[model samples]
Target: MHNPALDFAVNKENKTITIKREFAAERPLVWDAYTKSELLDQWWAPKPWKARTKSMDFREGGRWLYAMVGPAGEEHWAVADYQTIVKHQQFIGVDAFTDADGNINSAMPRSTWDVAFVDKGPQTLVECLISYDDLAQLETIIQMGFREGITMAMEGLDELLVSIKK
Candidate 1:
């Protein structure tokens, strides 16, 4: 099992966002949570929201695309491209909002996200390091209700962790 840690913070200048979580599972299993759509579907969205993973090709040069719709039919799509993958140690990718055909929406800010799965005794430490282009871009996301959205996303991840423990 992994020992999951959970916390997220914006950089002092508000140009970056970092999320840390530990899971009481093995690195490989926890890694699958982020890389595989099957596992993601179980805990990808918080209550009142649902995730419909359009595609998840988690390999270098591959893309991960997903659509998360709220209860009221309001939907959002996101696309991430894998830049690096170091087995169970880490995964780095660029995330952005996109459309059905896997095209960058351009209307959204693009950010680099680095997720590390560190071995800690019998547990695993998962840290998500996200950096934006600038402070203004970060602010734009915040103004559009990012903090709560992110917090809720993390909570969805937590739900997944609990299910694995059972």
Candidate 2:
């Protein structure tokens, strides 16, 4: 089987980051993996870190509150508020770092994510456009190893998709 590639792009001028990845699964299955909290918790975080959802409401105007638990049991929380959803096609949301109680942390950069899913025969192409408030915020995330972290997470997703197909 051919492994799909992951494309990550940074646009400092636009204050945005774009990531494209292909999954060896159909669009609907890929969409479910993203939307369902159960599936998300399974592969959302990279290895040595686990994603634990505190609460989730997967609908427009709803939000997902989750924490990334490090190997040492330390936790970092985040919340994503869903702005729009179009079934298996696309979804838009605003994501921000937060406390476990779900209070947004103003010190951290917030981003708006517009994610699209496109069907490619037996595979699904997932495109994510993440926009930040300014260049400083964009640079902050990059400096924080966003590329490497996301790459690892997506690789985890790849393994997840294969296992779920069984």
Candidate 3:
């Protein structure tokens, strides 16, 4: 088995972050892991933090509302509004921190995410581009440990793929 590396880059001038990760699974399975709420809840959050979806509608113009629950039982909610979707290939969405009622938190940073899945023989490569409105918003997320959190979450996904492959 090949060990895939995660490529994460921050482009300050563009106010965006790009992440590329290769998974040992095929494109269809990987796409399901990302698009299905049940599958995502299994590996979306870092350890000691659990993801719980309150509601989800995985169509264009629909939204997913979920919370990342801490070990202490605290919850941080967020919503991802899907703008576009192309089965097994790509999807675009706007993500924002939100209240439990699904109201966006204006003070928090919001971003537009473009995620693509590509077939690479036995593996699937996921490319993600996240754009913020400005550099300040990008900086805020970075300072809040976005890099570390996402890296951990991806590692969780790696474990998930391996277990589900059998």
| Residue 32 error, candidate 3, Å | 0.5
lDDT of 2 by residue, 24-62 (tens): 999998999999999999999988799999999999999
Model 2 residue 65 CA deviation in Å = 0.1
What lDDT does each candidate get?
0.79, 0.94, 0.94
Q: In candidate 3, how many clashes are counted?
A: 0
Q: Give the CA lDDT, 0 to 100, for residue 107 in model 2.
A: 93
RMSD of 1: 2.5
Q: Could you give candidate 1's per-residue lDDT for residues 33-70 as a string of tens digits?
A: 87889988666776678888888888999988888788
Clashes per prediction? 12, 0, 0
Worst 10 residues of 2 by lDDT: 1-10
Q: How accurate is candidate 2 locally (lDDT)?
A: 0.94
Model 3 lDDT-worst window of ten: 1-10
